[model samples]
Target: MARELMKGNEAVAEAAVRAGVAAYFGYPITPQTELLEYMSRRMPELGRAFVQAESELAAVNMVYGAACTGQRVMSSSSSPGVSLMMEGVSYIAGTELPMVLVDVMRGGPGLGNIAPAQGDYNQIVHGGGHGDYHSIVLAPANVQEAVDFMALAFDLAEKYRSVTVVLMDGMLGQMMEPCELPAMLPMKTEFPDWAVTGAKGRERRFLTSINLNPTQQEITNLRMLNRWAQVEANEIRYREYFMEDAKYAVVAYGSAGRISLSAVRTARAEGIKVGLLRPITLSPFPREAIYQASRKLDGMLVVEMSSGQMLDDVLAATRFTVPTEFCARIGGVVPYPDEVLDSIRNLVKGPLTTEGHPRDRWLKRMAERN
Candidate 1:
């Protein structure tokens, strides 16, 4: 209602209540513990339902059960726990259920430490579950955007009648920021008559992805692909800053995007022509925006917490008309301003720093502290 200090996970929880989420089912996991904590308190206040299922696996299935009734539901977890939920996500997507999931990512191919990381980018955006289904993935750069994006995720999920996700990291979830969310909008979405709720007078309806008939399965796959094409036509979203008169473009998302914004401004002030392109929607990613940037800039620099995830999309969008450079920080560290600015300077630069480079200097500082 009013502006207040909140963490990114807290904002997601608050936004869930405001988005008219009918049910929440989740199990505990770190980096996202606050999200569950917030829901534990607020879901009761709204007379809604909240259940901590036996495990992440069960929690996701519970969400599936609720969504089968055509109720809006959500669940949240970290990397390891989310891996367990993959089986259920596949089921939900195969049946084409409309539900939202929040993933506060941490490092790993396994049970990693409780720190921020973007290693899940491919898994979250590329459909981690088996099969050919993609979730509508939203990437938010700050606490405010995180709150705003989660609301958007709900709308898209129900609109496409598909699963959607808000992909964020530990920095956003654990840090504090100002937020003023609006009043909860009343949701009035309905299940199609084809949906199998109970089947009273007509023939019984079924919800299953299994089609033993090859021809029928082909028909279903093509239909889903067509829907994805329609979504791709309308779903790309992005934000740009100081790029109208830019010689170079920088592509980044989430907290890295925010850091890149400051670096672009800093580079400009130092007489180097640099600008930023930040993607808000990771799936059907902001391709058109990237193509527009490539038309004007010489080359674009792609930065991320993990190696080469977002860059792949940038290259696909631009198709190599412009050269690209990449810089990344793995294992949960934010990209330093100097490293980004140094990328600009390497090709074309202004005499601003006589002290080698900012990232090298910062890394040494980190080494000393450790």
Candidate 2:
């Protein structure tokens, strides 16, 4: 395929269309609004279904309906908008529907500003919905990753019979970059008898989580757990750099990670032996990769836009591997390269953790950490 320069949002829409997404339903939100616009223009041209929903909730429910028909459906929104879709996200998980959600995240809490914030890290990785459910979340760093990740999201969603999320930030959603996309695959829209479209030829498929009976709900929960365990065993992804010869490492993903990687190169030129452990799949969270890298490196730096939602994952993953310095900047602001460089500079000398200074873990509790 010919290489071309395109914005991240456009790349994702093209990727979805080419990779066999049957339908897309979404509401416009900042940062990711361009993505919907792109899909609106192109999906119809390709004969794919696209709906500009009345609201985020309606769009997500539309996803649920189409997913019930076994369509390769997707939806996109910013952080606050994603929060609005959490209920539907949980329902999708409980019903074990194969679908994709793209969260081109902006700032959080409640209508926080839109710039480029990784504040949605915890929400995306930890199942922002209410329940013991997990989505196969993919965090793409640049425009290319945005395109590449959408396909991965679809594959994983179908493979595990679960929801998958593509979590990007504003910079990733807005930036333009070169991409050599893979050849297009044949699209499929085969709805199985298990789907809840109608009783039709195969009895009736009950695609729902509303089990009012205690025994039924327990059974449903157990089924979801079994599926989750299987997913953990089979689905996990990450990207590693400079591990062959490195003393320190930084952990980040989405835009925060891409920039941290550039900073890693800068640190390398300055004789600082730094590396990066970027999480591509955030739910099955590449725990083994994290442990392996932490075992080899002297120290790790957890750099993120939020107060450090990803930092806790580092500590949990590296409990016996290595110590990590928690680095973060929250709200609508992002961490600059200098800040990441500074963290790497510190990691070059010593280990950093909660005990060293007492406040760098729970992001919401800022006063406690600083």
Candidate 3:
């Protein structure tokens, strides 16, 4: 396929269409609105279903309804909009329905801004929706990655009968890059046996997130847990850069990962033996890989566009075996490559300790710098 210069959100939307997405339901929100706009035009042209719902709540529920029929379905929104859909997201998870969601994250604790940010790390990766269920989350660093993960998202969702989230910051959503999209896939013709399509020919089937009896609810929860175990074993994904011979490393994801990569390269040129670990899957979180990397490192630096959310996960994975430091630019501010390079320089300078919380230390450093 010939490569085309495309905006991240539109490219991902087209990727979903080519992946045979049968229906799309979403509301317009900045940084991610282009995705919905693309779907509105393309879905109808392909004779597929598309709905620009009144609100995120309505959109997610519409996705929920379509998913129950065993068709490929999805929804997209920015940070605050995603919050509105949390309840419906939980309902979908509890029912073990297969669906995909794209979260083009923006700055926020509440109505922050439309700028690119990784602040949704905790919300999306840690199951923002109320439930004991887990969603498979994919973080893409660039437009190419954002485009490619769209098909994989649907495949994984259906494979595990779970929700799959393509998590990206607003920068990735709005930036333009050259990428080759996948070939169009045929729409699914055979519905799953569990589908709630008309029951005229077969036995009437039912699916619900509600398990009234306590024992039944427990059983449902157990089933979801067991399935998640399979996901953890088989789905962990991450990318390593220049780690073949390194004494120190940087951990980051999504756009932050992309930025950190540049810093790592510059640091390498300056005789700093530092590499990058960019997580591709945030849920089945490359824990084992990080643990192994920690075993060989003197210290690690975590870079983020948020307030060190993923840093906590890295700390747990490494079990504090290696001294760790953190640097971040939260609330719509993106850290420059030079800033991360400076952090790398500091990481090599020593006095790094595994004592108190990395965030606490980072806060002190940030305060001093300001």
Give the CA lDDT, 0 to 100, for residue 16 in model 2. 85
- Candidate lDDT scores, in order, read 0.83, 0.83, 0.94
Best by TM-score: 3
Q: In model 2, how large is the Cα lDDT of residue 45? A: 87
Model 1 segments more than 4 A misplaced: 187-189, 201-203, 347-370
Clashing pairs in 1: none
TM-score of 3: 0.99
Task: Please give the lDDT score at residue 147 for candidate 3.
Answer: 88
Residue-pair clashes per candidate, as listed?
0, 1, 0
Better of 2 and 3 by lDDT: 3
- Candidate 1 matches the true fold with a TM-score of 0.91
Model 3 lDDT, residue 110, Cα: 95
1-370 in candidate 3: lDDT tens per residue?
8999999999999999999999999999998999999999999998999999999999999999999999999999999999999999999999999989999999998999999999998989999999788999999999999989999999999999999999988999999999999999999998888999989878999988998899999999999999999999999999999998989999999999999999999999999999999999999899999999999999999999999889999999999878999999999999999999999999999787888888998899999998
- Each prediction's TM-score versus the true structure: 0.91, 0.92, 0.99
Tell how far residue 216 is off in model 1, in angstroms.
Answer: 1.1
TM-score-based ranking: 3, 2, 1
Order of models, best lDDT first: 3, 1, 2
